[model samples]
Target: MTQDTSTRTHCPYCALQCAMHLQPGDDGTLTARPADFPTNRGGLCRKGWTSAEVLTVPDRLTRPLMRKDRNADLVEVDWDTALDHIAERLLTLRAESGPDTVSVFGSGGLTNEKSYTLGKFARLALGTSQIDYNGRFCMSSAAAGSVKAFGLDRGMPFPLTDVGTSEVVLLAGANPAETMPPMMGHLSAPTLIVIDPRRSATAQAALAGGGMHLAPRPGTDLALALGLLHAAHIGGHTDHDYVAARTTDFDRAWEHAAAWWPEHTEQVTGVPATQIRAAADLLGRAAAHRSAYILTGRGTEQHSKGTDTVSAWINLALALGLPGRQGSGYGCITGQGNGQGGREHGQKADQLPGYRKIDDPAARAHVAGVWGVDPDTLPGPGRSAFELLDALGDGGGPRAMLLFGSNPAVSAPDADHVRARIASLDFLVAADFVLSETAAMADVVLPTTQWAEESGTMTNLEGRILRRNRATAPPEGVRTDLEILSALATRLGQPAQRFPTDPDTVLAELGRASSGGAADYSGATPQRLDDGEALYWPVRAGSAPTPRLFLDSFAHPDGRARFQAVEHRPPAEDTDPDYPLLATTGRLMGHYQSGAQTRRVDELTAAEPDAYVEVHPDTAARAGLAHGQWARLTSRRGHTRARVRLTPTARLDTVFVPFHYAGEQAANNLTNPALDPTSRMPEFKVAAVRLEPDPAP
Candidate 1:
């Protein structure tokens, strides 16, 4: 039944970025159905199945706009006028308040082509060092933690499919069933090690399928990780050969773990001592197999202690001499589609393209040469997301901002503060398919093309580079992200000449920057992606990118993984007398972050149109709340009211909310702003709150 419609491609909903073929109906409807591929295997999630509808939504933007005054409504404007407005404002701002007062905010959703070019434009043209992106809240901690321990921070050093062969899988802080369900074929056992404060859908699926659920207290994953590593020491599981030959300061790391044995870590993590020891033994035994993968996810990354938790996870794997082998290594299951590639391209505040730190002289030289700019002129290591936003105004913050493909108003940690900062901006422009919550606050909104109308590439969680081919022509007035960047850059008189009017040229620039770097993509040219099968990263010239990582040598300086000495820290907010319950938030299978695109889809909207708190019956009873009834959830940070749904899925004292809804029901509105000092990510997973009946009204 297969036809010759292989010319089209689509993006997988998760970070795996599995490139797929789109065979439009004979009548020309561009709906995407799964096609068999090596990585995806014809398996797609609910989100991916409906992704095709996103491009055809009725509210999609289709023209440029500008507003003359703060209270004035947006007026239709030509592309020239819009670009000119942006350029003139930038020039005026730079002259009046200096370069530091203006900055840009990029997104992980942007194509690798768009992402890398934006990094270059910011440093070379704007000459502002305050640029940052939304990824700082998501990818920074995982990246920093993995690099500190194993010297690499993409998802896995090994391909995810290798998880099936392992004896035991540590499902710590990750919910693949909901996050990336298609990959579950990698797990052969139901009794994989599941760790989370909340027995989420992933844990529940594992339990129903006969898996082990190790429920730890919120914000204390580091403790359980410490306990397991300590058990590795006591159980004689430590790889002394790998430690001494391939690692540094073995004695110091062991001593650090010994100081907080399983018993002590039990206190911090709320897991019994016996359970901790048993889990460690299980991991050690399973690791002996040919392909065991330790996967980390958002549960471990979105907090301030995010890095340390990631390091501990990697340390546990290193103790067994796991990494740099076939399927036995530490990996992170990145959330955003381009979470890996986005960070690699330097959209982050503190890095350059190809996973190099901004301050690194060699990396600076490499990137500057790639961009054809003076290395000295390129600013290095700007503030992270929170700091960049907090720096707006008096202490020299970006006065003007250009946002693309993101809705920060609903998605940011403390949205009110983000709204205020955007309001304070001298000029703001947003380019998206619709008037997203963040875009609603913009001085001008430019209609932009969606995934179906764009052609480029995205790097997945497994480090696979896949094609994103256009399935349909963009709307009459809409344009691609690359086109927008190029046109706007030209208006600024510093056009991205190398990538002008060509996505392939932009990809070439990204490929060139990947040279001589850890995430080499020279072989991942537009040509290789054109081939049928999926290829993993570390792509080199005239050769293959390694399908799975750590087949031989680790990326660490010594070619072996290091056991990090990680201690535990509690979540910033904890339940007390007034806030006597714990609250956790995450995604729903029916909706995505901010719900801007999905909510617009009628079918998706009907499935879950409103927000509700998942409350355990016992907790709901104690709080005078009932299923299908409204209740007020008050947290240390703020409060929100939602309809209650009694569900056994939630832990006794914890209430769960989905972050997809906006307005008063928005979970971020009630979430704490205290960030993981290390990751700068607002702690969306854990907060302290109390619930009560929504007063008689």
Candidate 2:
């Protein structure tokens, strides 16, 4: 065999983003070896180790394929023809049905530069108001609350390293050990508290470390958050000085939160009064000089009350004087690689490039100047993800959809409903390396390069923008997502004049969009990121790109923070005899989201090949269940059959399922579509379900 000299790049399996050295063997085989990096410490997850094999999958789309009819097979087309048709159809859709009649969906998995470039196309060339991404179902809710309270959405506030000096860390929503292992090393603290509906790996670790784990009823996390903060207030834990100096409307916030005093919260949240007090006491018992961190993940974000629930967490953090401090505060743990970047770059329906609202006149002017377009030419903000799709099936809806790596059919809330909406569209195009569950239903499939074959930048959860290098060339025909999008925009006749042709140029443009805008990044060039220099957002001359945000003042107009004063709302789905159990979905250690790419790999597949519904041993016993037995998990939205395994992690009446499976086992199939009003995130974590024995597979 001959030695291979493939370029080295970062793994696409998880947000850990471990760098990899890919060597293509003489027989056209790709081999991946981990690069010694600070983040992964030269360690690779099962999924990362075998990610290279996904490139050689026999079923990979080798060329652009256009389907002439719903019942027809895909016909291969060259790049020019394929791109032209895609652009033409999109323009036609917009001209006839209006920009809102078509929607653009991006994925968090794309490289930061690709992510940035795609948004540029969507907003400029397309002129579509119905633009959103899969993140609306993952981490937006936590973001909404953090932004409202702390002026930024930081996963750990400072960085993963900041958690190293902490004494007690409250693990809300996130399960790092199983989902993001690199986070575990940094968050290894003396006391780790976990609050989730299911006993996830993080929750279990918290319990094992002799810390408290609060398993509230589904959709009642907001209620529990209120209870805990109210307890803090009742126990004289309110930060009166900070509140008075840096915030307004405290009186109103306190009034609303006071209603959730211990007794009332106990009834609504199902968390015991004593437990709530005990948890607060542990926090209160911490040394005044020591660090305490409150971090939330999807568990808190994917609900109708997601914003309110996260607001409750923020209220607790502010009440405890955590925000704007070194040792304590609330932070949102984002799940996507560019979850922070994707939204910041005008991809969100209502957002511009720098966390500014498109509807805001000043923000519009700044961005329009950067993009060389008129601010008044842009349409007003569009519908969020959940609202966008529901309207697709309505009378006056988008006739076309262009999905970029987002598999809403499997990953979106109410997958069954989303699939129908996709089917309803007259023209659907999917640009992805793999034929995802959603892409399988598309009218056209455009093969695009993956992370390993794309050279760009990615902004991590901490807002650190780093360079991502291409380690290997894509298959002969596959093109970068940005390249395809650009060509298609040109083909559609809405030529994006002056659009940057390379990722570096795109970043430069993105930085320009940030100048004089909220979360400015005018000086954040790709060369700086490539040189191991990451300038956090709000970059300006002599500013040093604020490493720690809100240290001096909040971003609000009055230079102060505002409390959400949120209250609890019941989970849309409730337990009943017909649906007597609760189902919670999440990621596992060996795999990334949906497992579209991960499960295809040999090593990762060997670790966890199929899905299982985890039930409490007691609940399983009563239901006459045994481990590894098939169980039918039914919910109000829908149900799927999976093997049942008894695990102590789940509380009684609640079962757990991993969302990695495609086909019938995708857990999002049963998730509720109801959304948080402010953030537009759906309830993906919890819903009512019932379990019954299945005869056989």
C-alpha root-mean-square deviation, each candidate: 2.1, 2.5
By summed lDDT, the worst window of 10 consecutive residues in model 1 runs over: 5-14
Question: Candidate 1's residue-wise lDDT over 1-697, tens digit each?
Answer: 8557644565645686554666677666666677766556787777777887887788778888789887898888988888888888888988998777778888878888888878877777777787778777667778888777767776766666666667767877888777677777666453477887777778877677666778887788887887888897788777677767666756666676777687888777778888888877777776665345577777876776888888888778777777776657777778788878888877887778777778989999998898887889888678777777666654357788888767777777666666677778878889888888888878888898887777888888778887888777787988877777777777666845744657788778777887878877777777777865566777877777777765565677667666677777778878889998878777877787788888987878898878899988999999988799988887765677789999886678788888888877778777776776766777777888889987747
What is the C-alpha local distance difference test score of each model?
0.77, 0.77
RMSD of 1: 2.1
Off by over 4 Å in 2: 1-9, 19-42, 259-264, 393-395, 495-497
Clashes of each: 7, 4
Q: Which stretches of candidate 1 lie over 4 Å from their true place?
A: 1-7, 26-28, 188-190, 393-396, 495-499, 695-697
Q: Can you write out model 2's per-residue Cα lDDT over 1-697, one digit (the tens) per residue?
A: 9555875667775555666788777686778887766566676766667787888776888798888788898788888777777777777777876776677888877766666677667777777777888777777887888788766665545655666677888877778878877667666665887888777777778888788888887778888877887788888767688888877666777777788877888887777888898888677555244467788888777888888888878777777777777766667777877777777777788888877888899998887887778889777788888777776744357778889978888888787887888888888889987788878888889998877667887767777666777766788998877778777766655555556568887777777776776667777876566666657666764467766677777777777888876656678768888888888888888777777887777777787878889898889888778998888777888877778888886779788899988778888888888877888888787788878886555
In angstroms, how far off is 95's CA in candidate 1?
1.1
